[model samples]
Target: MLGSLFQKFKDGLRKNTPTFQKFFGKVGGLFAAKLDAATIDELEEALFAADFGVETTEEILGEIRAAYRNNKDLRGQDAAKIGATVLSRVLEGAEGQFSPNPEHHPEVIALIGVNGAGKTTTAAKLAWRLQQEGQKVILGACDTFRAAANAQINTWAERLNVEIVSSQHGADSAAVAYDTLQAAKSRGYNVAILDTAGRLHTKGHLLEELKKLGRVVQKLDTSAPHHRWLVVDGSLGSNSIEQARVFHESFGLTGLVITKLDGTSRGGALVGIYRSLKLPVYFVGLGEKPEDLQPFSTTAYVEALFG
Candidate 1:
């Protein structure tokens, strides 16, 4: 299962890595062999095309150029070495903060996003991860407006063997969330993962519904819903940024969980999101399976992207 996820990551990297046309025709052989300005430009374009984004690519190229200026003797493998170094430097400190606070009582995690953003799936995956850590979890189906939403959480609950609190369809989601928190308290569950309805970010009514859910959770534990995660489909490209903006404005998102990353070529959206929101990327969904939901690690991600 995980092998396929890793393979997809590898495939994305291979497809996006420096194209043969630029690498072989323009940059000479694997050995650096003293590259000229034109060759450097080609290399830069290749990285940008690979979705490294212009700023990241230029920063990397700048580092390579600076290194070359200091040591003119640098050649084929030397160029590759410096290129990798620059990439590593650019992505060096971009690590993920995936560890949820186990000490916090009822570590409430409220997952929110637009329809088809993979919010329910991510909630289930996160709940599974928490259960694996030996924490008793309660899955809260706060998306009461959608019939399938309740069934979705129930399915995950059965599969994970965790308890869930849900209500009838078209019920007040905030009331569901409130009742769920009390249930978690009474049942002594260590965590509560609330799955809110998925609506277009432009929908004011739906967005206000999420805010109300937040207020309800806060009423119970004050720190309830400690984490408001926005699940984004990486395949949506730049639109993910706009979606995030709407959610952040409405719910004050704490972090992001990007899904379908392996299926998209515009991986630059990750960088764009970080640049635009400055929120930590908590996790990424690489595939459809539960286990395919992998914790986001910026270092390993850069390596996989350049592989």
Candidate 2:
């Protein structure tokens, strides 16, 4: 069902990545002619319009100017080629994958985010991906305070044929987390994916609830809840970076998962977030399905974005 659909979405992401097309459009015609003052001005507006942020745009363009100066013969499409290489170079090493060591088998990854950040869906996607890798996974529905938290995860649990440790609505979420870890440990699940409450960092009580769950998990296994993933909606643009900064302060995030890449024009925020946070981007969600999640790859991402 979703598995097959997600495969298509991931394929489409690579084929029609927004970043690649944006860059190609901006530098395409300008660099199609010999390098000149006019072309450089056009390129400047393009970088700013692309939402690369002022500093980043300046940094990339500065590199391009240096490259052009060194090689006076570079013109036309070749000029654009050098410019693209410059952008890719600045974006190098930003791609990465989120992989928890099995040494902490039955490792716990606490997925944290505000509501609508695709927290529930990401958890399901991650569990499915881990299962495909031959790891036994258990899900913990610790978002009991939400109306649909348990139901959302239950749908995924059924689809994945995995066990879920959950309690009735309004139950103490930390208690559910405590029990889930115990159950996962006893059952020998290689990974425990904990679906925590989705609350904005500014929400005092809810943020504390997330901390309580983390504390409970740690009591069970000092390093349990080994990784904390902050899921951000890609469309938020500049606001997304602020969210990451806020959440990171509150949760001590270990990684990030930006969702809804297929629907947003501000995909440029991906670059902004990376430059600002410098944290590991464990995965990104392209659609609603479980398999739409993918590990971060800076080179492939920039290539896809500019195409």
Candidate 3:
């Protein structure tokens, strides 16, 4: 039973990762026998194509080249192992950690990002995850900027049987957050997850509105919104780095939750985002299912890509 469950977990992580697996099949050998000049070039190109970023790509290739120089017969398996080691080193300390603080009753977690980054679905998934762990979680549909946002979150709240606080379209989003936290505190809820509007991250006014939401929530618990996670679309590759930087500058984001990795060919962007901001990745959308929103695991990620 345990083995079957573990295999299913790994299969889920490998969704749409066949390109990578085919490239580095069976321990290694995208090329035959020995590491030659042409094979080395191919490896470099593959890493770059996977969106490993220039810095990381160079580092991995540099190490492999050095190894080849030492041993003219350096097999692809050895080279692949070396590349995975370098990547694992770069992604060190990138996993996020969290626990409900007893002092901060109803610790707030604000999910922020641009539209189509899967914030609403991620919000619902996270709420369900927390509840499964016995945390009294409540959803806060604080995205008053879009009417559909309110309706979508409401639907998930009903499906998950989780309580939520929301307002009409164009209502004050900060006010919704304030009320959500207040309700969580009064009713003894352990955590309140706030689903913020999909701010474009470029508009000055939109970011200012995000700042206001933060300030308003602090009035309730001072340390409310303890987890300001920026939900990013992994398919955008390094393009997401600049957007995340903008949100981080304005909102002082605490962590990241990268979504859409289940289908993105450029899943390596997670490394660039972490390298740029040094924020821990709290969760990743490995698939569309609610159960597929798994916690960030460096081991699982490197294994999936390198194997």
Candidate 4:
């Protein structure tokens, strides 16, 4: 299952292949000849172009430098192997698998991100995926502020055949969230995915509204909102890292769902975001279909990049 999923992910990442090929191709040349300062500089430039972020790129470079120092005979493929290992090490810690704890009935997952990050669609896709796994799920259309946000979620609810709780436009979003959880408990749904209003992390008022929504959920169950996920646009590259940082600081985001990986060459930003934030990436959006949102696999992701 994971192999198939990885292939889909690799297919979505075709745009990035040439970049990785060129990067590894240069490194291969360096190793074929003699590892020198010029070779290291060239590798650094490639990583920067790949949008690996400064800190992560430097760490990768440091790892290669140390490996070369330790083993003077290290070849290009060896360097690539070391790079993959270093990348994997950075993404370790957070569990990629997401299953609701039966004990925590109606596991609440709050999806948060800026406008146009694909939160509503991702909520629908997640509901579809969880339902495929035989878990009863409900969606909370808490994004009342966005015009037609409730309508969009309602449409998805009907198509997915899942229960959804929503209110009229301009309603208090916190109230919608509260009622959604209430309905989830009453209906015995295993998962309650709340679709919060998309807001810029820079907006203080909007951030406060998000905090209010969390508080409302906590009112029912303190440990509720079991997962706080940030749906980010992978195409945003390094900007996505800043967005993640702000959201993490504001809400203590538990995981990430990076969308639009299929459309951009900035997929390397995944490594930088995961490395800097140390948050598990639960799923990656490769395409528009429901199944395109595949579970994130470290091995698959690294191989897709270096291959």
The TM-scores, one per candidate, come to 0.84, 0.84, 0.92, 0.88
- The runs of at least 3 residues in candidate 2 whose Cα sits more than 4 Å from the true structure, single-residue gaps closed, are 1-36, 69-93, 200-202
- Residue 215 lDDT, candidate 3, scale 0-100: 92
- Clash pairs of candidate 3? none
lDDT of 3 by residue, 1-307 (tens): 2233223434533454554454466644453367788888878877777788998989989999999999999877777788789989999999897788888888889999988998999999999988999999988998998888899999999998889999999899999999999999899998899998886445887788889999999998787789999999887889999999999998899999988776566777789899999999999876666776878888777766674
Q: TM-score of model 4 relative to the true fold?
A: 0.88
lDDT of 4 by residue, 262-296 (tens): 75667778888887788888998877878878888
What tens-digit string does per-residue lDDT give for candidate 1 at 1-307? 4444656765664455545223422334434356667767777766665566667667767877887788776554555555566656654434457555767668888999888999888888888887887888888888887798889889988987778899998898999889888988888887888998986344898888888888888888887788888899887766678879988987888888888888566665677676677787888888877788887776556545543
Query: What is every candidate's alpha-carbon RMSD to the true fold?
Result: 3.6, 4.0, 2.7, 2.9
Model 1 clash pairs are 31-76, 32-75, 32-76, 33-75, 33-76
Candidate 4: residue 254 lDDT (0-100): 93
Error of 3 at 184 (Å): 0.1
Q: Which has the better lDDT: candidate 1, or candidate 3?
A: 3
lDDT of 2 at 4: 43
Instruction: Please identify model 1 stretches exceeding 4 Å from their true place.
Output: 1-7, 16-39, 68-94, 100-103, 200-202
Q: Which 10 consecutive residues of model 4 have the lowest summed lDDT?
A: 22-31
Tell me how candidate 2 scores on lDDT. Answer: 0.73
